[model samples]
Target chain A: DQQVKQNSPSLSVQEGRISILNCDYTNSMFDYFLWYKKYPAEGPTFLISISSIKDKNEDGRFTVFLNKSAKHLSLHIVPSQPGDSAVYFCAASKGSNYQLIWGAGTKLIIKP
Target chain B: EPEVTQTPSHQVTQMGQEVILRCVPISNHLYFYWYRQILGQKVEFLVSFYNNEISEKSEIFDDQFSVERPDGSNFTLKIRSTKLEDSAMYFCASSEDRGQGHQPQHFGDGTRLSIL
Candidate 1:
Protein backbone atom coordinates (compact mmCIF):
# COMPACT_ATOMS: atom_id res chain seq x y z
CA ASP A 1 0.00 0.00 0.00
CA GLN A 2 1.13 3.53 -0.64
CA GLN A 3 1.33 5.20 2.75
CA VAL A 4 2.18 8.55 1.21
CA LYS A 5 1.03 9.86 -2.18
CA GLN A 6 1.50 12.75 -4.56
CA ASN A 7 -1.31 12.26 -7.05
CA SER A 8 -0.01 14.93 -9.35
CA PRO A 9 3.01 13.69 -11.23
CA SER A 10 3.96 17.14 -12.48
CA LEU A 11 3.17 20.82 -12.09
CA SER A 12 4.06 23.97 -14.03
CA VAL A 13 3.97 27.63 -13.16
CA GLN A 14 5.09 30.96 -14.61
CA GLU A 15 7.98 32.86 -13.17
CA GLY A 16 7.09 35.17 -10.28
CA ARG A 17 3.85 33.25 -9.66
CA ILE A 18 2.87 31.27 -6.63
CA SER A 19 3.28 27.51 -6.96
CA ILE A 20 1.73 24.91 -4.75
CA LEU A 21 2.52 21.22 -4.41
CA ASN A 22 0.25 18.89 -2.49
CA CYS A 23 0.76 15.60 -0.65
CA ASP A 24 -1.36 13.18 1.37
CA TYR A 25 -0.68 10.43 3.82
CA THR A 26 -2.70 7.55 5.24
CA ASN A 27 -0.66 6.81 8.37
CA SER A 28 -1.88 8.73 11.37
CA MET A 29 1.25 7.67 13.20
CA PHE A 30 3.24 10.15 11.18
CA ASP A 31 4.21 13.04 13.45
CA TYR A 32 6.74 14.91 11.32
CA PHE A 33 6.71 15.95 7.66
CA LEU A 34 9.41 17.23 5.28
CA TRP A 35 9.82 18.39 1.70
CA TYR A 36 12.93 17.81 -0.42
CA LYS A 37 13.86 19.20 -3.82
CA LYS A 38 15.92 17.06 -6.15
CA TYR A 39 17.80 17.86 -9.32
CA PRO A 40 18.65 15.18 -11.83
CA ALA A 41 21.68 13.10 -10.81
CA GLU A 42 21.98 14.89 -7.46
CA GLY A 43 20.89 13.92 -4.01
CA PRO A 44 17.73 15.50 -2.67
CA THR A 45 18.15 18.82 -0.91
CA PHE A 46 16.15 19.58 2.20
CA LEU A 47 13.45 22.16 1.94
CA ILE A 48 10.93 23.28 4.56
CA SER A 49 9.11 21.09 7.05
CA ILE A 50 6.45 21.21 9.76
CA SER A 51 6.00 19.32 12.97
CA SER A 52 2.73 17.52 13.58
CA ILE A 53 1.99 19.90 16.42
CA LYS A 54 2.20 22.94 14.15
CA ASP A 55 -0.06 23.71 11.24
CA LYS A 56 2.43 25.79 9.31
CA ASN A 57 6.09 26.69 8.92
CA GLU A 58 7.73 29.20 6.63
CA ASP A 59 11.26 29.96 5.52
CA GLY A 60 12.33 32.56 3.03
CA ARG A 61 10.49 31.76 -0.21
CA PHE A 62 9.02 28.48 0.98
CA THR A 63 6.08 27.80 3.26
CA VAL A 64 4.63 24.43 4.26
CA PHE A 65 1.11 24.07 5.58
CA LEU A 66 -0.16 20.92 7.17
CA ASN A 67 -3.79 20.00 7.77
CA LYS A 68 -3.48 17.14 10.20
CA SER A 69 -7.21 16.57 10.31
CA ALA A 70 -7.25 16.03 6.57
CA LYS A 71 -4.04 14.02 6.54
CA HIS A 72 -2.76 16.43 3.91
CA LEU A 73 -0.06 19.03 3.45
CA SER A 74 1.07 21.52 0.84
CA LEU A 75 4.26 23.44 0.00
CA HIS A 76 3.91 26.92 -1.33
CA ILE A 77 6.63 28.87 -3.12
CA VAL A 78 6.18 32.59 -3.48
CA PRO A 79 7.39 34.26 -6.66
CA SER A 80 8.63 30.98 -7.98
CA GLN A 81 11.79 31.24 -10.06
CA PRO A 82 13.26 29.11 -12.79
CA GLY A 83 15.82 27.82 -10.36
CA ASP A 84 12.96 26.27 -8.42
CA SER A 85 12.42 23.73 -11.15
CA ALA A 86 13.01 20.27 -9.73
CA VAL A 87 11.27 17.21 -8.34
CA TYR A 88 9.74 17.77 -4.91
CA PHE A 89 9.20 14.85 -2.59
CA CYS A 90 7.08 14.70 0.54
CA ALA A 91 8.09 12.38 3.36
CA ALA A 92 6.57 11.50 6.72
CA SER A 93 7.82 9.74 9.83
CA LYS A 94 6.09 8.87 13.08
CA GLY A 95 8.91 9.50 15.49
CA SER A 96 11.72 11.99 15.50
CA ASN A 97 14.09 9.22 14.40
CA TYR A 98 11.83 6.83 12.50
CA GLN A 99 12.26 5.86 8.84
CA LEU A 100 10.86 8.16 6.23
CA ILE A 101 7.81 7.22 4.19
CA TRP A 102 8.14 8.94 0.85
CA GLY A 103 5.68 10.03 -1.81
CA ALA A 104 6.18 9.34 -5.52
CA GLY A 105 7.09 13.00 -5.92
CA THR A 106 5.89 15.94 -8.01
CA LYS A 107 8.03 17.54 -10.70
CA LEU A 108 7.76 21.30 -10.64
CA ILE A 109 8.55 23.29 -13.79
CA ILE A 110 8.99 26.99 -13.33
CA LYS A 111 8.69 28.56 -16.74
CA PRO A 112 11.01 31.47 -17.36
CA GLU B 1 28.96 22.60 5.72
CA PRO B 2 29.22 18.85 6.25
CA GLU B 3 27.65 16.60 3.60
CA VAL B 4 27.25 12.89 3.07
CA THR B 5 29.64 11.48 0.46
CA GLN B 6 29.03 8.36 -1.65
CA THR B 7 31.66 6.71 -3.83
CA PRO B 8 31.39 5.37 -7.39
CA SER B 9 28.83 7.77 -8.82
CA HIS B 10 27.73 4.93 -11.11
CA GLN B 11 28.37 1.21 -11.16
CA VAL B 12 27.43 -1.53 -13.60
CA THR B 13 27.65 -5.12 -12.45
CA GLN B 14 26.59 -8.47 -13.84
CA MET B 15 23.92 -10.57 -12.22
CA GLY B 16 25.10 -12.96 -9.47
CA GLN B 17 28.07 -10.75 -8.76
CA GLU B 18 28.60 -9.21 -5.38
CA VAL B 19 28.86 -5.46 -5.06
CA ILE B 20 29.61 -3.08 -2.24
CA LEU B 21 28.66 0.59 -2.16
CA ARG B 22 30.44 2.85 0.26
CA CYS B 23 29.54 6.06 1.99
CA VAL B 24 31.16 8.56 4.33
CA PRO B 25 28.65 10.35 6.50
CA ILE B 26 29.18 13.62 8.32
CA SER B 27 31.82 13.58 11.06
CA ASN B 28 29.56 14.45 13.97
CA HIS B 29 26.40 12.65 12.82
CA LEU B 30 25.33 9.66 14.81
CA TYR B 31 22.66 8.22 12.48
CA PHE B 32 23.11 6.83 8.98
CA TYR B 33 20.60 5.57 6.41
CA TRP B 34 20.45 4.01 2.99
CA TYR B 35 17.65 4.68 0.53
CA ARG B 36 17.09 3.70 -3.08
CA GLN B 37 14.91 4.93 -5.94
CA ILE B 38 14.08 2.79 -8.89
CA LEU B 39 13.73 4.51 -12.23
CA GLY B 40 10.78 6.88 -12.16
CA GLN B 41 9.76 5.73 -8.69
CA LYS B 42 9.62 7.15 -5.21
CA VAL B 43 12.66 6.77 -2.98
CA GLU B 44 12.31 3.88 -0.55
CA PHE B 45 14.04 3.25 2.74
CA LEU B 46 16.37 0.29 3.09
CA VAL B 47 17.95 0.64 6.51
CA SER B 48 19.12 3.02 9.23
CA PHE B 49 22.21 2.61 11.40
CA TYR B 50 23.28 4.19 14.64
CA ASN B 51 26.13 3.54 17.04
CA ASN B 52 27.63 0.93 14.70
CA GLU B 53 24.41 -1.13 14.65
CA ILE B 54 21.23 -1.25 12.67
CA SER B 55 18.42 0.66 14.29
CA GLU B 56 15.72 -0.03 11.70
CA LYS B 57 15.24 -1.67 8.34
CA SER B 58 12.40 -1.96 5.87
CA GLU B 59 10.74 -4.95 4.26
CA ILE B 60 12.81 -4.43 1.13
CA PHE B 61 15.98 -5.19 3.00
CA ASP B 62 16.38 -8.94 2.80
CA ASP B 63 19.07 -11.58 3.22
CA GLN B 64 20.83 -10.49 0.04
CA PHE B 65 21.51 -7.06 1.55
CA SER B 66 23.72 -6.19 4.49
CA VAL B 67 25.07 -2.96 6.00
CA GLU B 68 28.21 -2.49 7.99
CA ARG B 69 30.05 0.33 9.73
CA PRO B 70 33.47 -1.31 9.65
CA ASP B 71 35.33 1.82 10.65
CA GLY B 72 34.67 5.00 12.55
CA SER B 73 33.79 6.97 9.42
CA ASN B 74 32.78 4.57 6.67
CA PHE B 75 29.38 2.93 6.20
CA THR B 76 28.95 0.24 3.57
CA LEU B 77 26.12 -1.68 1.92
CA LYS B 78 26.73 -5.05 0.38
CA ILE B 79 24.53 -7.05 -1.95
CA ARG B 80 25.69 -10.66 -1.78
CA SER B 81 24.41 -11.60 -5.21
CA THR B 82 23.12 -8.88 -7.44
CA LYS B 83 19.99 -9.14 -9.55
CA LEU B 84 18.63 -7.12 -12.45
CA GLU B 85 15.96 -5.60 -10.26
CA ASP B 86 18.62 -4.04 -8.02
CA SER B 87 19.32 -1.27 -10.53
CA ALA B 88 18.56 2.09 -8.99
CA MET B 89 19.99 5.26 -7.50
CA TYR B 90 21.27 4.52 -4.02
CA PHE B 91 21.46 7.45 -1.61
CA CYS B 92 23.22 7.75 1.74
CA ALA B 93 21.94 10.04 4.42
CA SER B 94 22.92 11.16 7.92
CA SER B 95 21.55 13.15 10.78
CA GLU B 96 23.34 14.68 13.73
CA ASP B 97 20.48 14.12 16.12
CA ARG B 98 18.05 11.25 16.58
CA GLY B 99 14.50 12.46 16.48
CA GLN B 100 12.29 10.16 14.48
CA GLY B 101 9.61 12.62 13.52
CA HIS B 102 11.50 15.86 13.48
CA GLN B 103 15.09 16.22 12.25
CA PRO B 104 16.14 16.48 8.61
CA GLN B 105 18.47 13.92 7.01
CA HIS B 106 21.18 15.20 4.71
CA PHE B 107 21.81 13.12 1.60
CA GLY B 108 24.71 12.31 -0.70
CA ASP B 109 24.66 12.78 -4.47
CA GLY B 110 23.99 9.02 -4.74
CA THR B 111 25.50 6.11 -6.63
CA ARG B 112 23.47 4.87 -9.55
CA LEU B 113 23.77 1.10 -9.63
CA SER B 114 23.02 -0.58 -12.91
CA ILE B 115 22.71 -4.35 -12.66
CA LEU B 116 23.00 -6.19 -15.92
Candidate 2:
Protein backbone atom coordinates (compact mmCIF):
# COMPACT_ATOMS: atom_id res chain seq x y z
CA ASP A 1 0.00 0.00 0.00
CA GLN A 2 1.20 3.55 -0.78
CA GLN A 3 -0.40 5.26 2.18
CA VAL A 4 2.93 6.98 2.91
CA LYS A 5 5.58 7.86 0.35
CA GLN A 6 9.03 9.46 0.18
CA ASN A 7 9.57 10.41 -3.44
CA SER A 8 13.29 11.05 -3.17
CA PRO A 9 15.42 7.94 -2.88
CA SER A 10 18.58 9.90 -2.04
CA LEU A 11 19.65 13.39 -1.04
CA SER A 12 23.01 15.13 -0.84
CA VAL A 13 23.83 18.20 1.20
CA GLN A 14 26.78 20.13 2.60
CA GLU A 15 27.81 19.34 6.13
CA GLY A 16 27.04 22.79 7.48
CA ARG A 17 23.88 23.42 5.48
CA ILE A 18 20.25 22.70 6.06
CA SER A 19 18.83 19.32 4.99
CA ILE A 20 15.18 19.00 4.18
CA LEU A 21 13.23 15.76 3.70
CA ASN A 22 9.67 15.57 2.42
CA CYS A 23 6.89 13.02 2.81
CA ASP A 24 3.28 12.64 1.68
CA TYR A 25 0.39 10.54 2.89
CA THR A 26 -2.89 9.59 1.25
CA ASN A 27 -4.70 8.69 4.47
CA SER A 28 -6.21 11.72 6.15
CA MET A 29 -6.98 9.88 9.36
CA PHE A 30 -3.31 10.01 10.39
CA ASP A 31 -2.90 12.41 13.27
CA TYR A 32 0.56 11.69 14.61
CA PHE A 33 3.73 11.97 12.54
CA LEU A 34 7.30 10.98 13.43
CA TRP A 35 10.74 11.07 11.87
CA TYR A 36 13.34 8.33 12.31
CA LYS A 37 17.00 8.02 11.42
CA LYS A 38 18.63 4.67 10.74
CA TYR A 39 22.16 3.48 10.18
CA PRO A 40 23.23 0.70 7.87
CA ALA A 41 22.36 -2.25 10.09
CA GLU A 42 20.55 -0.73 13.04
CA GLY A 43 16.95 -0.16 13.98
CA PRO A 44 15.32 3.19 13.36
CA THR A 45 16.15 5.87 15.93
CA PHE A 46 13.41 8.31 16.85
CA LEU A 47 14.30 11.86 15.94
CA ILE A 48 11.32 14.21 16.12
CA SER A 49 7.52 14.21 15.99
CA ILE A 50 4.53 16.46 15.46
CA SER A 51 0.80 16.09 15.99
CA SER A 52 -1.90 17.15 13.56
CA ILE A 53 -3.20 19.82 15.88
CA LYS A 54 0.01 21.79 15.43
CA ASP A 55 1.69 22.76 12.21
CA LYS A 56 5.26 22.78 13.51
CA ASN A 57 7.39 21.26 16.26
CA GLU A 58 11.06 21.89 16.89
CA ASP A 59 13.66 20.13 18.99
CA GLY A 60 17.22 21.43 19.05
CA ARG A 61 18.20 21.59 15.37
CA PHE A 62 15.43 19.34 14.12
CA THR A 63 12.06 20.72 13.12
CA VAL A 64 9.01 18.90 11.69
CA PHE A 65 6.42 20.81 9.70
CA LEU A 66 3.01 19.42 8.93
CA ASN A 67 0.55 20.70 6.33
CA LYS A 68 -2.76 18.99 6.92
CA SER A 69 -4.46 20.73 4.03
CA ALA A 70 -1.92 19.25 1.61
CA LYS A 71 -1.49 15.97 3.44
CA HIS A 72 2.26 16.60 3.47
CA LEU A 73 5.03 16.78 6.08
CA SER A 74 8.68 17.73 6.10
CA LEU A 75 11.72 17.42 8.34
CA HIS A 76 14.49 20.02 8.52
CA ILE A 77 17.88 19.51 10.12
CA VAL A 78 19.97 22.67 10.43
CA PRO A 79 23.76 22.53 10.19
CA SER A 80 23.80 18.94 9.09
CA GLN A 81 26.76 16.90 10.27
CA PRO A 82 28.50 13.92 8.80
CA GLY A 83 27.02 11.69 11.43
CA ASP A 84 23.57 12.76 10.25
CA SER A 85 24.06 10.90 7.01
CA ALA A 86 21.64 7.97 7.00
CA VAL A 87 18.28 6.78 5.79
CA TYR A 88 15.44 8.93 7.12
CA PHE A 89 11.94 7.54 7.42
CA CYS A 90 8.70 9.41 7.97
CA ALA A 91 5.91 7.56 9.77
CA ALA A 92 2.29 8.36 10.53
CA SER A 93 -0.33 6.80 12.76
CA LYS A 94 -3.98 7.25 13.58
CA GLY A 95 -5.01 8.36 17.09
CA SER A 96 -3.97 6.00 19.90
CA ASN A 97 -3.77 2.79 17.86
CA TYR A 98 -0.07 3.50 17.18
CA GLN A 99 0.10 1.34 14.07
CA LEU A 100 2.77 3.27 12.15
CA ILE A 101 2.54 3.58 8.36
CA TRP A 102 6.07 4.10 7.06
CA GLY A 103 7.57 5.67 3.96
CA ALA A 104 10.17 4.21 1.63
CA GLY A 105 12.84 6.40 3.36
CA THR A 106 15.30 8.87 1.87
CA LYS A 107 19.04 8.29 2.17
CA LEU A 108 20.78 11.51 3.26
CA ILE A 109 24.39 12.00 2.34
CA ILE A 110 26.27 14.84 4.03
CA LYS A 111 29.43 16.01 2.33
CA PRO A 112 32.15 17.92 4.13
CA GLU B 1 19.49 4.62 28.37
CA PRO B 2 17.39 1.46 28.06
CA GLU B 3 17.07 -0.16 24.65
CA VAL B 4 15.25 -3.11 23.11
CA THR B 5 17.25 -6.30 22.58
CA GLN B 6 16.76 -8.98 19.94
CA THR B 7 18.49 -12.34 19.66
CA PRO B 8 20.21 -14.18 16.80
CA SER B 9 21.01 -11.24 14.58
CA HIS B 10 20.98 -13.53 11.58
CA GLN B 11 18.96 -16.70 11.11
CA VAL B 12 19.06 -19.03 8.11
CA THR B 13 16.44 -21.75 7.83
CA GLN B 14 14.90 -24.00 5.22
CA MET B 15 11.71 -22.96 3.46
CA GLY B 16 9.50 -25.42 5.33
CA GLN B 17 11.18 -25.04 8.71
CA GLU B 18 9.69 -23.20 11.62
CA VAL B 19 11.49 -20.18 13.06
CA ILE B 20 11.07 -18.22 16.24
CA LEU B 21 12.38 -14.66 16.66
CA ARG B 22 12.92 -13.36 20.15
CA CYS B 23 12.91 -9.81 21.54
CA VAL B 24 13.22 -8.13 24.94
CA PRO B 25 11.64 -4.71 25.02
CA ILE B 26 12.73 -1.87 27.21
CA SER B 27 11.80 -2.11 30.85
CA ASN B 28 8.66 -0.23 31.94
CA HIS B 29 7.30 -0.19 28.40
CA LEU B 30 3.82 -1.74 28.12
CA TYR B 31 3.17 -1.67 24.38
CA PHE B 32 5.02 -4.05 22.07
CA TYR B 33 5.03 -4.44 18.30
CA TRP B 34 6.56 -6.50 15.50
CA TYR B 35 7.46 -5.19 12.04
CA ARG B 36 9.36 -6.51 9.05
CA GLN B 37 11.11 -4.88 6.11
CA ILE B 38 12.01 -6.60 2.91
CA LEU B 39 15.04 -5.59 0.88
CA GLY B 40 14.65 -2.11 -0.62
CA GLN B 41 11.13 -1.74 0.81
CA LYS B 42 9.36 0.17 3.53
CA VAL B 43 8.82 -1.33 6.95
CA GLU B 44 5.51 -3.14 7.32
CA PHE B 45 3.72 -3.64 10.61
CA LEU B 46 2.84 -7.20 11.55
CA VAL B 47 1.23 -7.04 14.96
CA SER B 48 0.87 -5.07 18.18
CA PHE B 49 0.45 -6.61 21.64
CA TYR B 50 -0.64 -5.10 24.91
CA ASN B 51 -2.06 -6.31 28.25
CA ASN B 52 -1.27 -9.93 27.29
CA GLU B 53 -3.29 -9.94 24.09
CA ILE B 54 -3.10 -8.72 20.53
CA SER B 55 -4.52 -5.26 20.06
CA GLU B 56 -4.01 -4.95 16.33
CA LYS B 57 -2.56 -6.87 13.42
CA SER B 58 -1.97 -6.22 9.73
CA GLU B 59 -2.97 -8.30 6.74
CA ILE B 60 0.62 -9.46 6.44
CA PHE B 61 0.21 -11.25 9.74
CA ASP B 62 -1.44 -14.33 8.38
CA ASP B 63 -2.58 -17.50 10.20
CA GLN B 64 0.94 -18.90 9.83
CA PHE B 65 2.35 -16.11 12.00
CA SER B 66 1.84 -15.76 15.75
CA VAL B 67 3.11 -13.67 18.66
CA GLU B 68 3.27 -14.44 22.35
CA ARG B 69 4.52 -13.04 25.60
CA PRO B 70 5.33 -16.37 27.20
CA ASP B 71 7.01 -14.90 30.28
CA GLY B 72 6.82 -11.50 31.92
CA SER B 73 9.79 -10.11 30.03
CA ASN B 74 10.20 -11.70 26.62
CA PHE B 75 8.03 -11.41 23.50
CA THR B 76 8.35 -13.79 20.61
CA LEU B 77 7.11 -14.20 17.03
CA LYS B 78 6.87 -17.61 15.47
CA ILE B 79 6.46 -18.58 11.86
CA ARG B 80 4.72 -21.94 11.52
CA SER B 81 6.14 -22.69 8.08
CA THR B 82 8.51 -20.36 6.31
CA LYS B 83 8.44 -19.50 2.62
CA LEU B 84 10.98 -17.87 0.34
CA GLU B 85 9.26 -14.51 0.79
CA ASP B 86 9.62 -14.78 4.56
CA SER B 87 13.23 -13.59 4.35
CA ALA B 88 13.47 -10.12 5.76
CA MET B 89 14.64 -8.07 8.73
CA TYR B 90 12.23 -8.27 11.66
CA PHE B 91 12.22 -5.42 14.16
CA CYS B 92 10.73 -5.21 17.66
CA ALA B 93 9.60 -2.01 19.28
CA SER B 94 8.04 -0.87 22.56
CA SER B 95 6.44 2.21 23.99
CA GLU B 96 4.68 3.41 27.10
CA ASP B 97 0.98 4.32 27.29
CA ARG B 98 -0.84 5.00 24.08
CA GLY B 99 -3.29 7.47 25.52
CA GLN B 100 -0.62 10.15 25.46
CA GLY B 101 0.05 11.59 22.05
CA HIS B 102 3.49 11.53 20.38
CA GLN B 103 4.95 8.72 22.46
CA PRO B 104 7.70 7.59 20.16
CA GLN B 105 8.34 3.84 19.97
CA HIS B 106 11.81 2.52 20.77
CA PHE B 107 13.13 -0.05 18.33
CA GLY B 108 15.66 -2.84 18.59
CA ASP B 109 18.43 -3.69 16.18
CA GLY B 110 16.34 -6.09 14.13
CA THR B 111 16.87 -9.82 13.52
CA ARG B 112 17.53 -10.74 9.90
CA LEU B 113 15.88 -14.00 8.86
CA SER B 114 16.88 -15.71 5.65
CA ILE B 115 14.75 -18.54 4.33
CA LEU B 116 16.71 -20.95 2.21
Over B7-106, each residue of candidate 2 has an lDDT whose tens digit, in order, gives 9899999999999999999988899999999998889999999999999999999999999999989999999889999999999999988676558888
Stretches of candidate 2 off by over 4 Å are none
Off by over 4 Å in 1: B99-101
User: Judged by DockQ cut-offs, is candidate 1 incorrect, acceptable, medium or high?
Assistant: medium
Model 1: residue A55 alpha-carbon error in angstroms: 0.4
Clashing pairs in 2: none
- Candidate 1 residue lDDT tens string, B1-116: 78999999999999999999999999988889999999977899999998778999999999999999999999999998999999999999988675443678889999999999
**Candidate 1: clashing residue pairs, number:** 8
- Which candidate has the top score in TM-score? 2
Go through the candidates in order and give each one's C-alpha lDDT: 0.93, 0.94
In order of appearance, the predictions have TM-scores of 0.97, 0.98
Docking class of 2: medium
- The best candidate by lDDT is 2
